[model samples]
Target: MTSRVRLGSLIAMLAVAASGCSTELPGSAIAAEPSATPAISDARSGEVFGDLKACDLLEPTTTPKGFAAPEIERYESDNGCAAQKRGYASVSIYLVPEAGIDQLSPGQGTKIPTKVGGREAVEIPGDSGTEACTVAIAVTPNARMTASTSLNEGTNEEACALARELAVAAEPKLPRVG
Candidate 1:
C-alpha cells in the first residue's frame, strides 16, 4: 500500500478550494516523478489496461473522443492514479478497498444518486456551488471506484458530468478479479 502521507499529498495537490486559483495540498506539494513501474504490481488486473503502471486505462486510445489522454502518475498503491491534463480536465480515479484521505471533491457535496454502467452510483459536488465534483461507484462490497475532479477546465455541472462519463468509460476496463 502507498503510504498515507504520500497518497494524501498526491490527492491534496489536486484539491480545489473555495478560494480559487490556489489549490493547495494538506502537506507540502509533492512533485510527480517517473512511475513507469508502479509500487504495487499484483494490483494489475484491469481487463483493458492489464496493469496500473501502464496507465492506459484513461489513455487517448482507450477513452472517447474530445477527451485527451492524461499523463498518468502515481506515488504508490495508495495514491492510485492521477493526471492533470494540459488542455483537458484534471481528474483522478482512486481505486480503493476503503476510503481514506481524498482532497479532490472533498467530503460529500450534494449527494445526487445516479447510475453508471448499469450500477448505482452517487454524484457529489466538492462543495455546494463549487466547481468540483466526484462520483463514487461501488465495485464490490468492500471496494469502490472513486472518480473526482475540480472544475478548472469547465463548469461545476460539466465536472460532475465528466466524472460520470469517465466512470462509465472506466468500468469495462476495471479488473474483474478485484
Candidate 2:
C-alpha cells in the first residue's frame, strides 16, 4: 500500500480501537460512573458557617510578635484579615467555605499533617527560599480556615510555628463540626 493510504488506514484502526476502550480497572466487573453531584456531607455543605467572617475569628491579641493588629477585609466570596509589621512579618487569616484541608496545595513545599484544637489540619512549610508558611484547619469535609505567615527574617520553621499558633487561636471561634 502507498505510504499515504497506509497511514490513513493505521489512523482509522487506532480510532476504532480507542473508541472501544473502557476506563474500568482490569478485572473489575463494574465501571465506576461519575456522580451527577459532588459527594459533600451535611457538615461540609457550606451552610454551617453562614455569614461568619474570618476577621471575627481572630482577635487583635492573637497577632504574632512583630505584627500589628489585624485589619479586617471582606472579599467577594470570602472573608480575611491581615496583620503586618514593616520589615518583619505579615500574617493573614482566611475562611474558605466549600474548600477542605484536602484542597490545600503545598506547591513546592511540603504538607505535614497536624491538628488544631483536636481538629484535622495541615501545616505547609514555605517553598524554598521563601520565609512563609500556612496552617489549614479543617472545619468540615468541605470547609477550612487558613492561617498564613510571611516573614522578612525568619526560617520556614518559625513561620510555620507562627501560622499554627494563629490557626489555634482562630480554631475555637469556628462552628463545631460533626
Candidate 3:
C-alpha cells in the first residue's frame, strides 16, 4: 500500500509538471502575422549615381595654381578617380553609393565640419608627419563624394584648402540631393 501511494504521488507530480510544458515545434509560429518592421534595401535610401564615373566630373585642364595639368586615372573596380600632379600634389575623388558624410572614417586627423557649394561637408586635416587632407561632401542621406589631397611640400591647412576646392568644383556635377 505504501509503494502504491508513492507511485501515485510521483505520477501526480509529473502530471502537474507536464501541464506547464508546451507542445509547439521549433519553427512553428505562435500567430500567422506580418512583421512590424519593413525590410531595407538600396532603393529605399534615395537616388544614386548610376554609371556616372568620377573622372568625368572634373576637367584635366582646370587645376589649382602651381600644380601641373591633372593626369586623370579612373579606378578599375570602384567609382573613383585620381587627378595627380607629379611631384607636387594629387587629388583623388570617390563616389560612395551607400555611405554619407556622417559615415566617413576620419582616419588619424582632426575632423572639421564645413560646407562645399552649400552642401554639408567635413574636412579632416592630416595628422602629424603627414601632408594630406580629405573633404567629404554629402550627396544624399546614404551617399557621399570625397576629395582627398596630398601635397608634398604643403601644410595641413593648404592641403585642406585644396581638398575643399576640389570638392567644390566637383559638387555641381554630382546628383542633387534633397
- Per-candidate TM equals 0.54, 0.67, 0.65
TM-score of 2: 0.67
Candidate 3 regions off by >4 Å?
A: 1-47, 60-77, 127-129
| Top candidate when judged by lDDT against the true structure | 2
TM-score-wise, the better of 2 and 3 is 2
The lDDT values for all models are: 0.59, 0.78, 0.75
Tens digits of lDDT, candidate 1, 57-147: 4554224444445555553235355666556666777666443223223454767777777666678876434668878776554456777
How does candidate 2 score on lDDT? 0.78
Sorted on lDDT, best first, the list reads 2, 3, 1
Can you write out model 2's per-residue Cα lDDT over 53-161, one digit (the tens) per residue? 7777665435535466778865413578888889888778888776788987786688899988999999888843479998998988778888888889989999888
